[model samples]
Target: MALFGFIGAGNMGLPLMKAAAATFGKNEVIFTDASKERSQFVSDQTGIRFLTDNCSVVKQCKNLVLAVKPQFFPVVLNEIKDVVTKDQIVISIAAGIKIESIKSMLSNSVRIVRAMPNTPAMVLQGMSGICFSEDTFTDEEKEIIDRFFKSFGKYEVFDERLMNAVVCANGSSPAYVYMFIEALADSVVSYGIPRDKAYELAAQTVLGSAALVLETGEHPGKLKDQVCSPGGTTIAAVKALEEYGFRNAIMKATDACYKKCEELSNK
Candidate 1:
């Protein structure tokens, strides 16, 4: 079994640990966190070994997952920089932290895989964007990482330059989708639908629509056209949305998210 270690045990890290432990079993995992309580709690909950320090986890596991927030990344890197070695494969989920930045912070000899996984991973329905330098990973190593990511949700390997857009489209889109759901539910509630049932209906509709897009591989507009008859309810609602600037609103929101990602990287 391959040993895996997580350096942060918060929301994002905890889910990954849970999913990983379910696949590889708890014995193959180890972790450390800034919060000793959270570290102990997650270890107890998942039956993984918990260490008191970052270096301790680095020493025990060859596959290291850097799950700390971007703001704390440098500090964490400094803590384990001396202990990280060439054989250790470091997978970083810290958004906007470039692979080159991590390489410079640590030793250039260490293998690194940069990944952007969205909030959906918390619910095990994540879409992750993975990119690594061509020479940094062997076929077996790549397979292992791919398997681990798929165990949680979907994974796509893309050119590193597009990672930021992936952040906008997948990583940050969840919040926008949630907002859309909330607005839809609210509108129905105004029409006398029970608030709770309205939420369920709205959310499930979005879920089903997304599934249709994926399973059928049809253009979304074509799918929408199917729902809307020559002179029907769906088109009327869609027209209203267009009048309300729905497309423009979504584009602006994603653009803002993309800009924020760049800002984070600069910081």
Candidate 2:
């Protein structure tokens, strides 16, 4: 059997196909996309193979990754449910699709992993969160899937209830971070820095700051304090950010994102 099979080869799916190929080799990976040209593009880019249809992928592969967008899950699940076997592991990277919802379409006997992965995965720095249908996977199966995710970036397994929180935290937060970088670069440009240099400086600062948090395991507050010395420019900037309600704005944004995830789950 092929090691990894993808149901769609769009932006997120394409990178994941590459990661699976990196982990298991190209010959063991296969996929199918809605557009034949898209499927062919992925094949040419990664040297992976593609079949003509989703059920063909289900028949051939052991671990099936349903990488289609959330709206298409119902149709795609209906198409493959009949052909998917109990021995196959079906993993989904679509945001806001619940395990119970999938179990209703496919049988409870079918193994399902619901996951959310961000766009940074295109550059191999993606973070993913997963939740399994109860008692559905062996420890060995879990290990291989974990390795598959780590081939692109890091991953964490969470309780299914917290999966929406994962949506707001990492899955959608990159857009906010990118907006912050753009605003910071604009401010730098207003201060006479070249626009290209300003963007590079702002983006690198954000990247390094995130790296510090991940690498040091120190509280972000402590790191911020380190930068804001007594009567320093950093402290002055911090005071301005607080005055503008930066933290509150982020909290509100996350709350909205969480509510939207809940809405998607219900639909």
Candidate 3:
């Protein structure tokens, strides 16, 4: 039996399986997807066993990750609820799905951990927010969950009530960041730089800027001030961004994301 099993092989599932394969041997990881072709592809690429059905994955693995979409949770959980044992630990990556909801789907005695991880996890630089049900997981079980999350990137354990906020801050912010990079590259390309070179420069600048923030632990506003001197080009561009409502746009976008998460959780 594989040590870990993933019930979906889509975008989030693929990356998560890859992360788990890093900690457990590839052969120790098993997965199943609704699409046989998708499952086979992941199996071929990662050398992990691909079970033909979701129940097989649940039965064969001790640690099960419910990597299916939020909408499909009901169907998938119904399929495995009969076989899932109290001894197994189930981790869910479906956004907005709470621990209580999962417990209701299966059995209240089942150990459940909810996690929100972003697309950056594909590159092993993901930020994850994880929360576990009260009085359910032992210290060793919690350690196992932490190790699984950290295998891909950093994780913070917080109250599940803050999960919607985490979704806006990290889960959905990657798309906003990508849009910013695209706009930056487009602006440079308009100035006669090659498109590819513009993208490379823009992306690297964002990467280095983020690294600076993490490494120096300095306020981003102070860093901006460091680059902006009196009568400077950086300040001029900053003023233009302010006039264009750049900051307000980001604020509104994240707010929209948070609200959407709340709506889903309510459903």
Candidate 4:
């Protein structure tokens, strides 16, 4: 039996399936997409097996991953609900889809985990927020869950109540960061720097700054203070950022993101 059987092989599903294959082995992972062509493309790319449909995946795998978009969860869960066994755990990466709702859609006995992972998982540097339906896990189950997320990158288990916050903070935050990078690059390019060079410089600075924060364990504000000196260019930029409400913009953007996530959940 396959260790993981993915029901969708779209953008998020594809990278996550790749990560699972890397963690276990290609032979132990099976997936099926609504598009036969997409399944074939992934099969040709990874040499992993592909089943013909979602229910078939349920029968053949020890763990089932509901990787389809949130809007399609009702149909997909209905299709596999009868076949999903209590022995098989269901791990969902669908945004804003609550674990309780999934259990109601399928079976309450179904073991479920809700995870929010961003596009960064494509590069295996993703951060995932995991929430289990139950309060605790068995030793073996814990190992399986850890390997499942850590295959792509780091993971932190959180209360299911915070899953939407997880979506706002990290799962959707990458797009925000990309916009920031693009704006920085555009500003530099307007200053006569080659567009390509400007992007390279801006992206590297962002990458380095994140690495420094992770490595040093210093408060971000402290690090910002370190960069800003009296009568310096960095301080001037900081002042301009404050005057323009840069921090408020990001917080408000995230507020919108969180609202959307809540909206999806309430649907």
Candidate 5:
């Protein structure tokens, strides 16, 4: 049996298929995209077979990924609705589309997995959240989905209700983190450091700090304390950030993103 098939071969889908094929052999993967050139390009790079159409992908692969955007979902869903089977696992990456809605659109007995994966998955450092319905997935199926997600990076299983929250924390926050990196590098560059060197320093510091959090299992506050020597430069900068409402601004930004996720999910 083929390991997996992907219906969308855009940026995120291509990376996911690459990661999956890397973890689970390329010959077991099959896929197609709306754009035939891109579909063939991904298949060529990964050594996975490229099907002529989405229905062929569904008929041929046991595990199928629905990676099309929200706007394109209806058309794509209609195209393969006939071919998707009860025994097959259908995973949807579309933001805000609920599992129940998808199930209603297709066969009731189909196994469904809903997931929200961040942009970092492209670099094999993603944080993904998955939710499964009782009627749709067993514990074994959930484990399979979790393993598939972790092939790219970290993954956490959560209740379906929390999927939107995951979108805010991991999916939307990457852009915010990039903005922080750019701002930090700009500030350092203004102080005479070359822009490239400043960016390298800022990016590496953020990377290392995140790794520290994961490795040490320590609260970020304690880690911050460790970095701030008594009356040191780090303390001065921390004070400036506090004065500028940095923490409040970040909280508000995440809140805004969370609200947007809710709005999109309804759509």
Candidate 6:
């Protein structure tokens, strides 16, 4: 029997499955998807088993991951609800789906974990936020969950109520960071730098700056101050960004993302 069963084989699901295969034997990891071609492709590429039926996956695996889209959760849960045993733990990556909602769809006593993992998992640099249902896990079970998440990158356990904030802070913020990098690159290119070289420089600067923040454990504001010497060119560039409401724009974007998550959860 497979130890882990994933219900989708899309972008996020495929990366997660590949990561799991590193620790678990490829034969121990199985998955199913609506598209047979996609599932077959992943199975052939990774040497993991692919089942045709979702319920078959539930019957075979004790650890299940609901990697389907949020809108499909109801149908997927309904199909597997009858076969899901108390021994099985369901980990959900569907955005905006709450533990309580999942419990209501399945059995109240079912062990459920809701996780928010971003697209960075594709590159093994993901940040995941995890939360558990009222049904508690044993030490071994918790360890299994941690190992599965850490296969790709780091994770943190938090109250489910803060999941939306996590979504804004890490899950959705990567897009904003990408936009910043593109803008920076464009500005340099306008100054006669080659387009490709500008992009490389801007992207490397972002990567190195983020590394400095993590290594130094210093406040970002203080780090920014360090770069802005007395009447320096860096300070002038910073002033231009401030004049264009850069910080406020980011704050508003995150606020909007959080509100949209709330709206989706309510629906």
Which candidate wins on lDDT?
2
lDDT of 2 by residue, 42-120 (tens): 7887889999999999999999999999999999999998999899989998888899899889988888988998889
lDDT of each: 0.87, 0.92, 0.89, 0.91, 0.86, 0.91
Winner of 2 and 6 under lDDT = 2
Off by over 4 Å in 5: 136-143
> Candidate 2 — which pairs collide?
none
Model 4 clash pairs are none
Clashes of each: 0, 0, 0, 0, 0, 0
Worst 10 residues of 4 by lDDT: 133-142
lDDT of 5 by residue, 1-267 (tens): 677989998877988988889888887788898988887777777788888888988998888999888778878888888889888899898778888878777877877889988789999998988887667466776666777898999988889999888887887888989999999999988999999999999999999999999999999999999999998999999999999999999899988877877776676
Model 6 spans with C-alpha error above 4 angstroms: none
Clashes of 4: 0
lDDT of residue 13 for candidate 1 = 88
Model 3 over residues 1-267: C-alpha lDDT tens digits? 777999998888899899999886797799999999998888888888898999989999989999888899999999999999999989898888888889898999898888899899999999999888775677877777778899888999889999888888888899999999999999989999999999999999999999999999999999999999999999999999999999999999988988888878878
TM-score of each: 0.96, 0.97, 0.97, 0.97, 0.93, 0.96
Ranking by lDDT: 2, 4, 6, 3, 1, 5
The regions of model 1 sitting more than 4 angstroms off are none
lDDT of 6: 0.91
lDDT measured at residue 233 in model 3 versus the true structure, 0 to 100: 97
Give lDDT: candidate 2, residue 76. Answer: 99
| Candidate 3 residue-wise lDDT at 104 | 92
